[model samples]
Target: MKRPSVSDSLKRLMAPHSIAVVGASRDPAKIGHAFIRNPLENGYKGRLYPVNPGGGEICGIPCAPSIADIKGKIDLTVLVVPAERSIPALRQCAEKGVEAVIGITSGFAEAGRAGAGFQRELGEILAAAPFRMIGPNSEGIVVPKSKLQLTFSPMFNAMVDGPVRIMSQSGGMSGMIASRLAKRGVGIGALFSTGNEDDINTADLMEYFADDPGTGVVLAYLEEIRDARRFVKAARRYRNGRAVVVMKGGRSPAGGRAAMSHTGAIAGDDRVVDGVFRELDVVRIRDSHAAVDATAALSMMKWMRGRRVGIVGIAGGFGVEMTDLVETSGLLAPPFSDKVQKKLRPIMPFYGAVGNPIDMTGTIINQPDMFRDVLNIAIDSGEVDAIVILLTFVGEPKIIEAVIHANEASDLPVLVCWTGGGEDTSPACQMLYGKGIPTFDSPAAILTGLEALKAQAGL
Candidate 1:
């Protein structure tokens, strides 16, 4: 496989011979301050060059008043300057023969015409220059291998290292998801936010991640596709190395209206986008939780072993809803064969929804050991490839034990859906999450995660 475009550029940015922060600052509140602080605070192992007209030494690094003050070829320049100042900074970077520029500035196309004009000008500058640009209005990019946290978002500095690479059109969403995933113990290998995507779009980044050795899954959140053809082609090529899971906004007209007004995105036919997603084999998320949950599952679990899945939940109604999701999401829930049914019949005394859904009734709530026994039977029967364990309320300690045991016993990936609300079982949920089982409060999100896993594994 060919190397991704972003990886080499990323290596330069993360561990450049010298890096200049164009809008380097002393004030802690400013975006520039955060950008400079990340590398320093997180112990980024690279040469740091701070740039500011008034600079002497900001953040204890030797400051350069301008890009020219650098002694040799500067590998990367991070633009934390204002929207109007980006062009001059790009000109300086081009003059300095910098390999890449991370535009952490906003107020580009996302801010409308004047901002759009500024973004266009920056693009023209890059076109005439020899360097690559990550964004004109991006949060910035991160390459874990180089320990580079180029974004101004404070969260990136605290990121956990993992095999997934993330790209988003919304910087805030990207930061938010990355933060939450880190909290859940899933680190990202690289992260990019192509704000407005005037030049370095998601497709280009996806292509780069496709060949990146560290990346196993690519998680994306888009309001629109700037380059559809490149995205499809890249996704197809990356199918094995990196699975692309997307969460696109603008489904309803209300949502579409909001997306357009928010990011100047042209919200076209969502169904058409869906079809394109299908063609590219990209998994589209329905909600925020699904994005993180699907990322965890896809990054950790194998593809679906079979189309048929046994969804056993302590809650009867939640199991029923999961069954509905399975059918609608195109996964088959074939009825259990008589031989398998006989094995279950002797164990399950109460008449639950004993079809493919395999509702354990409230039996597991009382007899937690039964949960493991039932799961082992379900997985062993060769009737289902995956299991969805739904618990309404984890009031019993046995249930938790059973879940842990079941997870250990089964090779098939198990997704847990814990229904009900409030703080009663947050501990239990966290416990399950710690064990590498994706846990969710919403059955819909859990099912969505499973559906995405099935789609990616090509079951």
Candidate 2:
């Protein structure tokens, strides 16, 4: 009897029932300490073991001198020990039937010479075992909904779980994007950093995430992909309706060299990466910022079927700018029908223009419902597939609530581009984000994100 490739691997890799933190430490400042501290901080409800040679206690839990000393079936082990100690530690975990291990130490192939040799030995140990490994230089994993923040970053402790699951080769990128998305009140289902991938690589995780019940969007930031054919197969298998996004780094010669040194992996040809991503229908993004935006939009507005959009903004200048943006991004701002315009004519300001970019005019400042009224009209018109709401100032709770209500009533996706609102906008923007509306700071980003969403649907 054999463990099914997918289930046996990911159960321990992701939703582990019990774990042992192999270099679990005393000092909270140390990465070693994070393995124990982070999980508790995130409210992990599973059994946790701390392993140290001079075992006493870590965070008040009884410590084990080694994995063999631990008294139960260990599902996972987090190796935060040095490179020299990692081989023995990994061997012990595997012998003890530990299903998965995530090594967070940095001194492996990326460190050169002696470290490379150590990495090779570690690889051989992995190949001989029934266990799976993530990295010797990884940052661990975080599954927000499971209360599993297995990584070392305190910034992710308060993060909420959503449909976007991020898997990156760089731990810093995973944290940065997760924090950014979390700050906007967007939920993150899971995040993993696969550094110096010797055993479990991005493709394995991609296949897992593609079928993950919690994930609606999968974002990967790759310096290099270990297996291209496997990646394409995974993409095709899981791409039913979910968006699989990739941001391939190290496109330039110098950058490729840097990536080699950084991950101890070759940065494969960027052109081939692009072609494969296109052929597999994967959304290839350029930066983490855009990646975060794309993830949020795709995860939340997956129902959006068309590229037609309606613009609602306070300033005529912004409206004009957005008009240009729609044209450039290949998105359409369909004209409102005559009957819809007649209905809107009563609520709109006498002087305000109402075309595709429905400039509600500055009169919306005092009469905020006028803005809400326009939003209702645009949504009701059915002329647009999505609505772009740009605000110069976001005050008036009633109008916000009204717009939110209107947005809830319509199937049309409503996106916000808010700028210059200063302090008052933060809470309001957060409200929209919490409701799954993707918000950006500028006209270009809003339209650009809309276009990306449209592109995701192959429009």
Candidate 3:
């Protein structure tokens, strides 16, 4: 058997066996203390060595003065020291043969002119170095699989595991998006907050995740990319297998200024960015939540080459919106042929129609099996290539199971849109979501998700 070829330095950077935090602090309020608390609290099982010149103890672990004092193999160094000490610290890490350094200290390029100059100097010192660095203003990384939680964010404590790999220029943005997905019961494979792009840029990680078997989708939040050509090439490479969702910030002038202040990288022209994304065949998203939705849909369902959509639900309104969406998006709601309709007519309720939008009305609450019967009949009838089931209310959990079971038998993809009854239907919706069915709470959202999935088909 052969192993997937990953950059040796990147492997150490993300999945290091041993690590040293250069500025471990005793105070709980300090960022340095977070490095200790996050990894320790999250059950990281690697050898941890904290380095502080004071030679004090933090979280019951003794500190080393520097990398020079640390013995054994050191895979990575998390430098949380002050800006004045960050450059020299990188030099020391390089000397110690550290494979990577995560610069968590701020006051770099985003701070202003002098800080930008200092950051340039820091990058110069790392030229052709043995180890790669993540950020000078980064929040660090979290590898849930390896139990390597280097972030200080509290949200990571409850992080879930899944297929999306995150790349962000802003650490807060990365954590917030991944946390949102996690809160929705979605899993995140790895998250890299590549602040300032001092050494390891966004392009490098994208290329790495392209070959990574654990990653099924790539979600990126970018204010600025240092190397457009490299990032595009990486996107091209990753596109051969998985889905890439990019949410580019800084389109307006004010937003551009804010983006520069936020990450110290210039936002390129928005039109040019759009063209690049279009050419690469990647989905360009407008917001974080939509990015999550798209990733969820892509990760769960099989590619739907045929767009003949079928709507099944108790709510007639769901059928209306689904029909409208299909009309607008060039999707089809091809009515069941007379032969198939005649075959299913006796089983379907007399009051509701069995056209493309087979609304069963609220009577489905009484006969839950009727829902599955409708689904199985529709799938077997060969009238539609895809299904949009409106799981409006939870009359019985068995109906939900019926939907799942019915969909499992067909090659056609199924999307469940649970609407109305407000909070009453949430449990069922989440159940479907947990079962890997791109479940949405409303008709509009589900239709939008379907359109996104359709847009990315055969890419």
Q: Which model is ahead, 2 or 3, in terms of lDDT?
A: 2
Clashing pairs in 2: 162-187, 162-188
Give me the displacement of residue 436 in model 2, in angstroms: 2.3
Question: Which regions of candidate 2 are displaced past 4 Å?
Answer: 1-4, 238-240, 252-268, 420-425
lDDT of 2 by residue, 5-89 (tens): 6457776677888999988888778887888988987789999999988878888897898888989999889998888888888
Query: Least lDDT summed over 10 consecutive residues: which range in candidate 3?
Result: 254-263
Tell me the number of clashing residue pairs for each predicted model. 0, 2, 3
Model 3, TM vs. native? 0.88
Model number with the top lDDT = 2
RMSD of each: 5.6, 4.6, 5.4
Q: After superposition, how far is residue 123 of candidate 1 from its true place, in Å?
A: 3.2
lDDT per residue for candidate 1 within 71-104, as digits (tens), equals: 8678888888898887888888877778888887
